[model samples]
Target: MSTLLLGVNGQVGHELRRALAVHGALLAPPRTRLDLTDLAAVDDFLHQHQPDTIVNAAAYTAVDKAESETALARRLNTELPDLLARYSADHEAVLVHYSSDYVYPGDGDQPWHEDSPTGPLSIYGQSKLDGDEAIARRGCSHLIFRTSWVYSARGSNFLKTMLRLGGERDSLAIVADQVGAPTPARLIADASVHALRRYREAAELGGLYHLAPRGVTSWHGFACEIFRQARHAGMALAIAPERVSAIASDDYPTPATRPLNSRLELSRLENAFALELPDWQSQLSLTLHDLLP
Candidate 1:
């Protein structure tokens, strides 16, 4: 049976395709090949492919803009995934979906568990949480891996942003209040592949899992590490560490409020799958190595 992968264009999707290349016959549909917004097209594509498994990595990720375009975001984040989940349930296909750490309430500093009460502060977060519920309600064999602060060498992410700013600016004032694991897309994809390989044999699985790097760090800490690596690599930086002052979340107000604690409890995943994600610093170093010219 072939494996059908959706959202082949996103960072995670791209990395997943590369990692899963040798696993089986992979059928990936980019936006041009398969428009997920079109229900008819989605239904048709699933019917034709009839894949043994489906991995959905595509999402409407514009956090600030989602506040204005709530309807569009809901359609993509909520309805579309539900449609795919229903199809997967009917076909008895193993469905693997990616979720975010934003689903947790921004109130505390505790590492969020899979069963924690969800209280999304922004429209995008709310929509994503809704999508998770939608997928779970299908009652199909599924795994919803919730990850946070995803970055990749090839995609637009916090690490890439820091690289550009490091070269251009004298310093950057990053938020120090918000804390979470800075997960690499490659690691997330690798973990998904690991979990899916044991889907059938693992009895304690088939539920949500928190998959991120072992340690957590704020955005300010992440930027500091980025520059440190860049300098070690002999890359010139205009900014100095002292100039990179830490600021509160209110200093840079946005259309949507971000979670103060995006840290996720990965005990369930580690205990069940015996998988341990790398630390944020190590992952950042590897990603920067790939990004450096």
Candidate 2:
């Protein structure tokens, strides 16, 4: 089967290319070749490629900037997925799309189910929700995996940012109010491959599922662990454990309001795929190993 993988340059997309290549012929285009910002260009590329399967991992991920760049964010996070879902519906193809936990309102301490009441706090979150709703409404064969706090060894993410700042500065102030799992991009790709294989075995498996590690922590907790692991691995760092302080989300105001609760329930994904996901700490350890020299 011909699989068209979008966002090959992204954290998840980069990993998807590696895992999906073994399954089938993969078509991953660079932005220079086909600019996704151009809707007509995206539609044209879809027709030209005529893929049997499409995996979209690309997203407009600048949370704060998305407030002002609503049109651009909507184009990528909403319109692009809409176009792809339309194609999947008409051609009878399977679509595997990535979504965010920001779709849920950051109110309670409980983990959000796949069918949780969505109340996005920012333009980025709303756009992602819109894309997901569009795909569902299209009534196409699809699998939507909503993940949280994605980071990888290779990408510019929270993990890398902490490592750099930890080494350069003596201390850092991280928001502790927001809580969620730090899902590795590699894990997401592996699970996607497993879900696709299982979905092929039984088509009824296609639908929305929350994909994340088993446990959860706040952004401050995540940064502390990152420093701890990096130090344990004998990596150089200037930040002291005590100096790394935790603050509330309100202390660090940005253009976009962040959801305090990003915890997603993984029972649906686990039961459906029959896989045991690792905890956030263990996942961070593996990613740090890959990153630290």
Q: Pick the candidate with the highest lDDT.
A: 2
What tens digits encode model 2's per-residue C-alpha lDDT throughout 1-293?
89999999999999999999898799999888889999999899989889989999988999999999999999999999999999999999999999999898989899898988999999999999999999999999999999999999887999999999999999799999999999999999999999999998899899999999988899999999999999999999999999999999899999999899998999999998899998989989998999866
Candidate 1 per-residue lDDT, tens place, 42-156, comes to: 8898898898788899889999999999988888889988988899889988888998988888778888889899999999999999999999888888999999999998878
Give each model's clash number: 1, 0
Which 10-residue window in model 1 sums to the lowest lDDT?
198-207
lDDT of each: 0.89, 0.93
**Candidate 2 lDDT score at position 211:** 93
Shift of residue 64 alpha carbon in model 2, Å: 0.8
Q: Score residue 23 of candidate 1 by CA lDDT.
A: 84
Among residues 3 or more apart in sequence or in different chains, the pairs in candidate 1 whose N, CA or C atoms overlap within 3 Å are 170-239
- What candidate 1 gets wrong by more than 4 Å, as runs, is none
Error at 159, model 2, angstroms:
0.6
